[model samples]
Each structure stands twice: as structure tokens, then as C-alpha cells.
Target: MADKSNAESIITETQKRISNAFDVFDHESNKTVDVREIGTIIRSLGCFPSEAELHDIIAELEDEEPTGFVRYEKFLPTMTKILLERKFRPITEDLLLQAFEVLDQQKKGHLEPEELTKYLTQEGEPFTQEEIDEMLSAAVDPDKNVILYKDFVSMMTFDDTR
Candidate 1:
């Protein structure tokens, strides 16, 4: 019974977040948004579904009416499932550390700023110069001029913004 209630709570909370994300695109104050904005809304809620996944979602939602509008009410259940069951979340701290390890050829458990910047700006999902600088600024050990990747991973994966 407790598990069931907890699941319900999760569903409710997920729905609330989806609604809030949808609200951002509901400029007319109506509870509907353009079908095209579905992907944007889902991304805003922190779930980066792949292109194929997004296409499937849009196709399913468009099955009812070709109105090109998504009703938050109709979307709530799907959004909740996506939030609760989706696999593509921010990488785990350990995983992030492993990625950093690849750049740390010495296996020293840290990275020099220049090396990290080069990898971050030239590798898969490359960051812009500005992004690399911002992240390095926060994670760099000023005294050592290196990034303690373990600590950086911790901050990236678990920092409390509030």
C-alpha cells in the first residue's frame, strides 16, 4: 500500500512539472501548446528523449486530431511516464569521472585546464568556448591549476542549486 501511494505521489509530482514546463509555451494562457513545442517542453523538464523517440511521441499525439495543439490534460500521463521511466538522465558521477579519466592520460585523477578545455571543446557533444570556461572556472583548483575530477563530478551531478 505504501509503495502504491509513493508511486502515485511520484506520478502527481511528475505531472506537475510537466504542466509547468508546458505552461511556458502556453502563451495564450490556454492549457494547450503547439505540437512542435512538445520536444522543447520535454527537454525543459530535463528529459532529452532521442529524435526517434520524439518523433514517435509526436506521431502518437497527432493521431487524434491534426489540430497541431497539445492539451496538457491529454499529455499528463505520457509526460509522467517519460519523467519516471526515461533512461536518459544526466550521467552518473562515476560515469562522468570515467570520461574525465580518458582525458587524464597520466591517470592522476585530475585534469589540467588546457587539456580539459581541449577535450570539452572538440569531443562528442562539444562545449562552446564559453561553456568550457564557465565549467572550468567553477571546477578548477586554483592553487593546483587542475580539476579534481572526482569533486567536479560530485558538484556537477549533485549540486543543490537552491
Candidate 2:
């Protein structure tokens, strides 16, 4: 029963995250976004990757269909499985601090919206203005454009139980 509940929780979380990604993609472009966009979207959700790294994601999607525009249904399980498998670097407190280091362009101890956007793009993870704003609102300090170490840590740490 516990295992079933855990699976259900993971599925629900995956659905929420993927839904957010779809909204982010739609916000990024008025027209249809392709499967290649998945890498960028996932990265924007705070994953980092180089050009080569992103290509792997695109390649995986391409294997499913040539057009590369991964519909929401396709993206959810792919990403969820990736998360469950611990494929990418683990989301740890240390990693969260590193993300701030990457995002804090001004070195001002905080991350402004522009800085975060640039950082995300630099990491090859493109984000919509709305998505950037949302992430900032959730975790960043509006006054300083930086998130506190604790807040950043909290954002990345998963309870697994919840």
C-alpha cells in the first residue's frame, strides 16, 4: 500500500511539473513548440546541460518521432522516468548553491530575473519570461535579485515522502 501511494505521489508531481512545462512552452512561443524544446524547458525547470547534453534529450525524443515536438503526454513519462532513475546530477543542497552561483551574474548574492534568464539560457535551458518571473517569485529575493541559501536549498530538495 505504501509503495502504491508513493507511486501515486510521484505521478501526481510529474503531472504537475509537466503541465507547468507545457505552459512554459506555450508562453515561450505563440505557435507550436517542438520536441527539441523539451531540453530547454527541462533545463529551465533548473536542470543544466551543455549543447551536447541537450542534444541527447532531443535525440531521445526524435527516436519517438521525427518532428521533435514532444506532446505533453510524451514529455511527462520521459522526464519522470529520468528523475526517478537519478539520471541527472542529484538535486542536493550543494547543487542548489551551485545553481545560484551560476545564476548570480552580478555576484550580488542574489539573482535578478534577467540574470536568472541569462543563466538558464547559458546552461542551454531556455525559459519564458513568465516562467522566469514565477521561479523568481517563488524563491528569489525581489529586493536583492538573489535567493537565500536556505530558500534555494529548499527549492531543490525533494521530500520523496510527500
- Name the top TM-score candidate: 1
Tens digit of per-residue lDDT, candidate 1, span 1-162? 999999898788777788888889998898889998998887777766666788888777664657988887777877777777864465667777878888788999888888888877786767877878799899999899889988888886733221
User: Which parts of model 1 have CA positions greater than 4 angstroms off?
Assistant: 1-10, 20-78, 158-162
Question: How many clashes would you count in candidate 1?
Answer: 0
Alpha-carbon runs more than 4 Å astray in model 2:
27-32, 63-65, 90-162
Q: Please give the CA lDDT of all the candidate structures.
A: 0.79, 0.65
What is the Cα-based TM-score of model 2?
A: 0.47
Error of 1 at 142 (Å): 2.7
Candidate 2, residues 1-162, lDDT tens digits: the string is 999999999778876876776677764454345765676677655555566777777676554547646555556677777666655543667767777776565666655556666776676657667777777777776567656646667775754432
Q: What is the model-wide C-alpha lDDT for candidate 1?
A: 0.79
